[model samples]
Every structure is written in C-alpha cells, then in structure tokens.
Target: MSGSGTFAFTVHPRGRLREDLARAWRPLGLVPEAVYDAALRRLPLPPVTMATAQIGGERVGDVVLVPFGARHLLADVVGGRRRVGQAVDRAVALGADVVGLGALTATVTAGGMTLGERTDIGVTNGNAFTAAIVEDQIRLLLDRTAGGGSRPHIAIVGASGSVGSAVTRLLARDPAGARLTLIARTAPRLDALAADVADSVEVAVAHTIDAVADADLVVLLTASADTLLGPQHLAPGAVVLDATQPRNTSPDLRVQRPDVLIVDGGIVSVPSLRLRGGDIGLPDGRSYACFAETAILALTGHRGHFSLGNPTLERIDEIRARARELSHLGFRAAEPTSFGAPIALESRSAVIA
Candidate 1:
C-alpha cells in the first residue's frame, strides 16, 4: 500500500444530548438525523482531518472525530450493535484504510478482534500504545521519586488484561528492581501473570482495591466503567497514570488530595490537523496515544495490526522507533493535568511523615 494511501475512520458512541435532541426535534423538522447521517456518509468530520507527516521516514494520512457518546454503551447493552456497526461502516466508506476503535468502542468490540473481523478495513484496539505510554510515564515517575530516597512501589490495576500484562512485562525490566503489585478481579489470572514476570522482578497479587493502598506509582487500566482510585487508596505523594479514557481516577481525589500527581495516559498532539469544534476532554493540541498509533501507522504505510493481543517487546521497539523517526510529526504526553488543568505537585513531607 502507498504511504499516502493510508486513511483512518474512527467510530465513537454518539453524543447523548445530541442524539436525544435529534430524536426530539425530528417531528418539528428542526433537526434531521438523516441529513447529519448523510453528511457523515459523504465526508469525514472537518475538524477531524488528514494529518500529513512521516513515520519512520514514510508519509501517512489520518481521519479523526468524536463518533457518538456514552449512551452508545447503553445501546449496546440493549442489543444495539447495529447502530455501532453502521457507524463503523460509515468510516470505512469514507476512504479509511484502517479504523481505530477508541475508548468504549475498543472495549465494546472485544479488544478490536471482533471489530477487525466485522469491518472491511483493518482494526486496532490501540492497547499496545496505551501500554507503552503507561510504561513511559511510570518510569518517569520512578526516576523523580527515587531522587528523594524513596524507591517506587509499582502497581498495575487490572493486571490480568492484555494491556495490563504488557505493562507488567515492561516494568519488570526496570533496573531499580522496584516491587511490583498486580491487582485484578480474578486471582487465578493475576497469579498467572505474576508468574510470567517473576524472573524480572519481585511480584505480588491482590484481588481488590486494597492492593493499591501502598503503591507509590499506580497505573489504572481497569475495564470497569467506574471510578477505582480515590485519595484513600493512594499514598500522599503517589504518581498515577490514569490510562482509561473516561478516566479511572475518582473525582474525590481532586477535592481531597492536591498533593498527588495524576497524568492522563495516551495524551498527545497531532501536527497540521487543528481541532475546531469537538470536545473529547483534551487540552488543545493533545490527543490520546491510541489515536496517535493509528495516525503513525498510517503515516508509515503500515497496514498490519500494529497493536493486538498481548503486545511484545518487539512491537514496543518497532512503534517507539517509528514514533521517534516521525518525531517532527509525533505526539507527546500533554503536561500533567488533573480535573481539567495542570496539577501542581506540592511538597508532601508533612503528610508523608
């Protein structure tokens, strides 16, 4: 495939109020779902445009957007897969070379395996990139914490999942020999993952939130659509990377613990494609790494499934190299943000003691 031949279609759940108002206004002819639907069918969303750049010295193209909203999850629960399928198909029709499932779409599609099988274009869960970014953020935290004579205690929430498993593997290679904690709903799977990493680092497993209580650095990648981490679960000076899009960090933390640093994992900025009128809960010039992975792959003319199943070290190195080569066009983590603004990590010596 030609490098410029790569295009992307992103399927997101429809916005709740938009969908509801569209339905309510249909009888009055004030809003027409069909017209909006036809427009999406004919053109990719505007603020969502093609990013022209080189990844690994190869050119690429991308299509970006906020698909539907959170209600789509409820629709899926009510057997509304057809609506989701329609959204996916629309992107495919718009010259998309591959379609990336973002946030809930990824989880709904069963890690992109089912979505790939169903869509005409290639599909990626984007978990591999998420895994990579989480690892990177963790390492940065470890370095900062170690400067103060505190050896970081690493914790992975949802450690049994594919993304979590990949994170465990990456951190095990840490030369500081940090203590590792794996938390998940299932003990058996946690035990299995722990065994896999036992040679690289000391490992412990817990089947509940309490597993995170003593961790100095926590990576939240749980599949649960609810808040899992709060002030009570963390130490005073903890560094957390909330990898889940809707956010795995609790709102209470913002009100209660200003001393902790929480960074949104997968945040990145794309060059040349300016976001105009969409709100995907990101700072200006920032995007999720999963979104960047698709854009990077497209830029490099790579049509294969770059991130799928359990990501390996080889996959991480390949993508990292591609990102570096495309440095001029690549994405970086947005500054540390919590509750819609930059977080100031205050000295917590009083609290720590």
Candidate 2:
C-alpha cells in the first residue's frame, strides 16, 4: 500500500431485488424476471468506476462498484465466486495497490481467500476494522446511555460469522464486567467460542434471536438476507449495532420501538474527502468502515492481504492501531448514521420525549 497508489473498494448490490427498480417491476409485467436472469447469466457485469476519493486534500484513491446481483445469494455459489473474481480482476487491472471487499463479496469468498489467490494485489475483507469500530462505538454508546454505571449485558447474533465472532472476542478481552451471550444457528461453535474466553467474563450460548431480547446492547451480524430482529426482540432503551449488509435490524422497528437506538455499524467521518456522486452511498463527510480500512492501509503504506478469514486478535489490534494513526490525519468515526442519512439528535430525543 503506497500513498501514491490508488485502491479499489468493491461494493455489491445488497442482495435484494426489491431494492432494484428494474428487477422489482417484474410482477406487474412491467419487466420480466428473464431480464434479471439474463443479467445474472452475464455473471459478473462490467466493473463500474464509482468515484475518486481525496484524503487530507490529496487524491489518494478511487472507489469501484461491482454489481453481483441477488441471484448470487440465492444458492448460486459458483456465480458468486466468479463475480468476486471479476471485481478483483477489475481492481487489479485498474492498478489498485489494494482492494477491499464489501458485504457479500467478502463473506461469500470466505474472507477473500479465493479472490486473493486470483489477483496479485493486496486484498482485505474489511472485518478487522469493522470489529474494532463496533467495539469502540459500543463503549461510547454505553457511556452516553448508561453513564458508565454498571456492567451491561451484551448479545451477539450470528456469533459464528467472521465479523460477529471477532466482535465477541474483542469485547470478551475487555476488563469490564459486561456479561455476554453468543447466539448463532449452531451450538457447537457457540460452545467453543465461549470456552475460549477468560473465566472472568460471564458468557453463555443461545441459538435464537430471542436470547437478545433481554440484552442491554445487541450486535447484529447475521448473514441472513431477511430481517431477524424486530420490535419484540429488543429491550427498552437497548442499543443495536447492525453490521450486516441488508441490515439485520428492520426499518419498521423504528416505528415499533422508538426507544431502541439502532445505529448503522462501521460508519466513519472523514474530514479530508469531498464526496461527489451517489455511488458510494454516504452523505457529505461519512464513509463505510470497510472503505476506510482500504484508505488507511494505503495511507499508512501497509501492503499485504489483511483481515482474511477470522482475523487473529493480534491482527485486529494492529488494524485498530493503524486506524487510530489515520484518525490523527482527520479520518475518524462520523456522527451516527442509519440508512445513509444523518440520524438527528431530535429523533432520539423525540423517542424519549
């Protein structure tokens, strides 16, 4: 990762056809599913050059958007892999020093292992900083909401996945007395993760979202394409950190449970960059943590594949350190955001009012 070189941040469609107007119009005969099928058959569509990013008043890198449609999530593993490779190929062709995989591109490729093998450029799944950011934000949220009083009970959904598991490990390593419950579809993995923790941290295992209903803070990292946590699954005044692509927390929950604070995980505020187009999906000064990881790596001149698979505790620590170094240069977490919009302080106050 050289400061003079450019990097590509690969982003995918959020695996929901309903969000795409072209695909969403199929039912009324306005458009046909065959059109979407043809698009899928095309496999990895041509890489779209998204935007050029400037960091600290200098041109640092450019962002690329890759559209690997929803079919990749619907039991098309081979197609998913091809789409990932195509995105990597485009980045490599564009002379990117490194490429950061966003959303399903990272997960479906098994933390970018297979894609990394296909390209010579550095690659990252972006989970390392995502975990670090989520952990730091959780502590900040607690301090604001709970006033640093007593230890809070925490629940991590999809605890077996890479991001979820990393979050669990980092939080467990903290000296605080917060209790944690690991929730996933499998019991064996949950049991194994719990056994890995130190004895001082109270930890348990559950296989359902219901287990989080009593938690004071919930971190949602599930890979499910649909929503899991609803109004009923949150306790009053509970804060949820949603790290998934399609988002584990539903928008309906905002109306159903206004008391619950649902913040989009891994959004950072960058002071240097000015965003132009609508491709990257962030407001004026905000960025996704995954993209920020790539920029930080490039800025710090870290050249190598990072955050692959389940990152080791040491690796997570190193990424956090680098991110902090960037923070000194004006790369820091932005104000809390939900669905790419600024979350107004009055909205939260209105809920309490």
Counting clashing residue pairs in each candidate, in order, gives: 11, 3
Residue 103 in candidate 1, Cα distance off native in Å: 0.7
What is the Å distance of residue 288 in model 1 from its true position? 0.3
Error of 1 at 21 (Å): 10
The sequence of per-residue lDDT tens digits that candidate 2 reaches over residues 272-304 is: 666434345565566777788888787888787
| Deviating ranges (above 4 Å) for candidate 2 | 1-4, 15-38, 41-44, 147-149, 275-278, 340-353
lDDT tens digits by residue: candidate 1, 1-353: 24444655453424333443332233423545565544444453432332333333443434444434444454443232443455556556666666666776666656665555653666676777777777777776666554555556888888988788888888887637688899998888889889988988988999888878878778888765557687888876777878876678865785688767676666765544443333344544566777777776666667756665567777877777777756776455555565556654433311211
Give the number of the best model, judged by lDDT. Answer: 2
lDDT by candidate, in order shown: 0.63, 0.74
TM-score: model 2 vs. ground truth: 0.87
